[model samples]
Target: MTGRSGGFGDHSLKTLEESRKTYLQSLRVSTADATFFSHQNALRKFFSWYSPTANKPDSPGNTLAEFAKHLLTTLGQSVDTVAGHIHSLLNFLAFHHQSSPDELRVRLFSEIQLLSCPESAKESLSKEFGFQAGSEITRSVDALRAYLRQRQYGTRTHAYVELILAARARPTQIRLLNRSDLHLDEQTASIPLSETYLIAATGLHNEQTVDLPPDLTNVLETYIEHERKTPSQSGCQPLFTTIHGRASVGTLRRSVKLASEKARDYHCATRETNPDDRSPVDSVTAVVPSDIYRVALSDVENTS
Candidate 1:
């Protein structure tokens, strides 16, 4: 707040409004009539909920994340809807960055690029992106599974991905898991899908558990022994932790976003119908973390 502080400062109300107006004016130059209006509408929706907190020092990475989740859960917005809103917010961040002091650009710009558009799609790719149906959700999940497994960091993040896609764990639940919480035994058991041990993961309800497959059990073991960093303090071990101790919410979100992006083998048209006749139809232009994220959120809601 004192001097830009390297990234967008929600702590300052005056600056946030000024920055929004400035960005909107600049956005007019690059965006068409529809695009510009759409973004303006999104910004209005955001400002309706965002009340500036005074002197609340927080990381931009984390603050923006909470803002996004609030839009989804509290505001009850869908992934694509939230994505459109975030896309607008991201541009505002970038535009503000350009006019801010130079040193702050590096960190501010990094947040912009990381949060911008979830994942990059080539211009050569077709438009029209979203998870249009429950079946499309399935396909996207499968694709994301494979993509996460193939990445080098995948070894580290793959377990959480499985928990999300298979077990339907929320980000908060994943963050709260301890290394010891996993009921993994060194001797592999021939467990069936339905019979696999429950995760005992704490969520909205305290007694939550989920089925874990043998392959994923192995992956968890490998991660614990090889990929995971040893905790400095005796009580610090988490089921999945970054070098920073615990995976930040932003890290978890971005990991899911990357997986979703990679899952898109080809760009979809600007509009396309869901092929499933059984489920209600929707046309989506992009797949994002929320597609995966909402599963866990809904799971908790249903169970609760």
Candidate 2:
């Protein structure tokens, strides 16, 4: 009947208008005095819909239980979330009215019990209540790194994962490395080598003038001359470069992974075949093993 053309007569509409004015004034007063403006507004709206008498402290048919239920249903919140909100509202109302928490209605009292528990305990209880937490080991840092490394990760990409793992273990710093970080000298050759070459000469780190076996030295010299030459082409870096002519972390990671896999494959194939076997030639045993190749280089340097 509040200023509407309904079944109510003019007298009823006038009473409704007066009630609306009084309710608005009450809301304004409560909003001014309320500690939380949001809570005051919500309570004011609820009171307006349920009870129009503003001056009375107690309103007929105003129950905290019904209000809590209405709030939860209207908000479409989970049980735990609804319980927390109701508990907060109950506490706020009790404090505003200068009453004890115990004086709150049963619905809010029950919610307060649920909210008072420690978060860890509540999670445990929730699990016990059949709320399963989503968890997977496949998404772990190590697992993801391994997968990416297999797919040929670049240097920068590997560095980032390494940083994350290091941080997880303990706080640490990652320093950038450059070619200058490597110690290189003509006098000493700490180059890695294969077992066959190591058997021929003793290895030393940063040693000068290691003699290399003539044959191995010649092969190495040829390889270096052909493959390690300074590029005549513009925009090319010999030490490292991407297909597009730029060094990248992903490219480096992928190269190392591919190299390792090739080495492993060669080792396995050689191990399975007999050197004295008269069968057709094995492709794996035909290629130089990483260890043997490295030893050949060391032997060449040592003999030379």
Candidate 3:
């Protein structure tokens, strides 16, 4: 359903091309470089679909609305991705027709509403952390961090764990990061939008800056200075690496899993035991990178 534009008349095609160019030029001054490119790509896709070359008998009497449905249903894009496309299309329409996007959306797409279905905080914690309670999850994370800091500090394992906990990033995002992305002095790291899962999940188009906690910054500094190896290749400076080269996503996940298990075992073994009382450490759950992200979202919702 995407990139099929067989029905548009030549005049319509020319108008779309001109309007797209003018709209992008207008956006250039106000938007960031990554945002400009994202808008450009989204509009190109929208124009491809907007071509009168294709016909739909059940178009809901609105082209934009029909395209939105196609993006969600036929293309199977996440709601966030679909919203980006709709946003770009609305802005383009507003530019060409001299109307506000809000007015255009209401007049043309009043019946369409974009919504997302995600795991509830409790469900997410149970699924990802194997814990039903947020408090237990927090305790597990604290134990894991404490174990890493005391025993594995300055190693790749410690850096990876601290990075995920601080950044609340998926392993996929971490895999795409590079050493150049880190700004240790500023306590931030940039995640590029291209091929990033964060873009699909969060509706962020431009490069994303993840704020680093001071502890993570210090840990990263130690790892880089003493433990990290130079990339085997000249131009590839992956932020996380192994003895060979850049660390794979599998490596990061395995490291996280192992670290969590070790923490659980360490805490369970050393905990003061009473014959009468059930050990609280018995319920401690293993952590994963995604659990951190879910917990972070839950925190934000609670605070808001």
Candidate 4:
């Protein structure tokens, strides 16, 4: 009995032995580039013996199922791992056979059964791949700032960071904001900024005033007057321009990080001179507009 034409035709002892060797080779080659190749290889070898073709007819599908069982029971692979292997093997079969049912479909149900994730395995998978429990927005801000520092971004980059922070923007919002989203009142050097809100609000609620600290305001005013003097591009866009006039999200993120790092280094040096003080000097905290509003409203109530 020989394995030929992409299927096992006979169930003789010699044919079964050949099938086992082929399976072992297949498993070994499948994992050649993977870190867990050796473990997978060993599991396949055990399955070849436990479910020899001579003892049970070798259908492409059944062979896959037997290997899957070996992963679960013999090798003690977690359900997620077993399921992953099964998915890979199923995809391999589907691709090779050019369809789902090609002779291999005979054992598809059993393969699926072997791929079932236990409750414990499900929990483990969730823990490994679940959403992080903190504020993703804050994390994004920190990440962008770190990246900017690593790249040593410049002033335009700082404006971009301010844009995102002031807007309390999500990545998509940052990506979508354009010059149209901002209006420059040169008379007041005030930029009226609009951003998408996570929750719906009353009229014009999504817009926020970006109150730049006096130092930053002065720096920006200088940039706009000295640097952005060139005629506006055909589009009256505010957020991004290829030239020195506006800022892109990538540029902004990088700039924030560079500034943050410089600030940190500066703070560190100052702290070194005053060794008695352990508190971080430039520990900039994100101040969302809502928080500021709440604080201001509380102060007004207290004063009244």
What TM-score does candidate 2 reach?
0.20
Candidate 3 lDDT score at position 183: 92
Runs in model 2 deviating more than 4 A are: 1-35, 52-62, 74-81, 95-97, 105-304
**Position 113, candidate 1: lDDT:** 36
> What are the per-residue Cα lDDT tens digits for candidate 2 across 80-167?
6444444434443433332222223322332323443345533532332221111221112223344435543434334323322321
Tens digits of lDDT, candidate 4, 7-28:
3344455554564454445545
| Candidate order, TM-score descending | 3, 1, 4, 2
Q: Give me the candidate number with maximum TM-score.
A: 3
Q: Rank the candidates by lDDT, best first.
A: 3, 1, 4, 2
RMSD of 3: 13.3
Alpha carbon lDDT of each predicted model: 0.50, 0.33, 0.61, 0.42
- The local lDDT score (0 to 100) that residue 206 gets in candidate 1 is 28
lDDT per residue as tens, model 1, 115-141: 323343211011221212265675566
RMSD of 2: 29.3
Best by lDDT: 3
**Of 1 and 3, which scores higher on TM-score?**
3
CA lDDT for candidate 4: 0.42
Off by over 4 Å in 4: 1-154, 162-206, 209-216, 227-233, 244-246, 280-304
